[model samples]
Target: MLDSLSLDEFGLWAWWIIAAVLGILELIVPGIFFIWLAAAAAVVALVAMAVDIPLTLQVALFAVLSVIAVWTSRRYFARHEVPSDHPLLNQRARTYVGRNYTLELAIRNGRGKIRIGDTLWLVEGPDLPAGATVHVTGVDDDVLKVEAVH
Candidate 1:
């Protein structure tokens, strides 16, 4: 039975390979799904090499460790995550702060036209030049409100 499998060639090696693949995939996908599984697989491989554990035991260990790592990360996010108080995080999800915008229409009173990102927005603030840098403040409905930065 053992003759059929070589060292680090059985599921132990599979675990390590799967773990590495998952870890790399985690970077591309970036939602923290396979990262834990990868870690668990690595541990399983280490244990299999050091203790000569059976393939079945190695697989079981991988499953348990994967669950533990993923669940532990979920718990951390649930416990430590806090909702942002900024109105824009929900209200104006498309707007970004510190972004430079150009005023397309000068403000006569408190109304002006500015281009933010790829979309043009109607802003309300002090009178600004037609091509002045503006920072997005907040949004109402689909219209973005901005203020002249300089």
Candidate 2:
């Protein structure tokens, strides 16, 4: 084991700090991904002291471990799981675009209502008569931003 407060101490501390920062960033980004790499860093720190591995090797090992963790996590998520908790996690924002919906009411300021896929959504676009059909061009926060369909 290395002395508790030697040069190795700096390397171990650096790894932990970096991991913690990345783990926090993962929260903002969401994905449960970077936490694994952070775990890998903590493991490297332990292994570094166990074997007295040098600094360059420590960094190289960290890089390799982080990459492996990310790749493995991505593959596991890609092939075997559906997140049950995050409803918008399906990346459904773009799916609404180009869909045509009938206007349920008229709006005076680029806001209205429409139904797409059995779900009535608050809509925004040029004011239209009731029963007018509009094409969705985009979305903003669950609301369909639309224009006249024809």
Q: TM-score per candidate, in order?
A: 0.51, 0.51
Model 2, position 83, has a per-residue lDDT of 60
**Which is the leading candidate under lDDT?**
2
Q: After superposition, how far is residue 19 of candidate 2 from its true place, in Å?
A: 2.3
Candidate 1 per-residue lDDT, tens place, 39-143, comes to 888888788778977777777888889889989999998899767777456645355544667888897688888765676677777888798878877766665
For model 2, residues 44-120, the per-residue Cα lDDT tens digits are 87887688778888878888988898889889988998867765567676677887778877755878777666776
Taken over the whole model, the C-alpha lDDT of each candidate is 0.75, 0.78
Where is the poorest 10-residue window by lDDT in model 2?
1-10
Q: What lDDT is obtained when candidate 1 is compared to the true structure?
A: 0.75
Error of 2 at 66 (Å): 0.9
Kindly report which residue stretches of model 1 are placed more than 4 angstroms away from their true locations once superposed: 1-12, 82-150
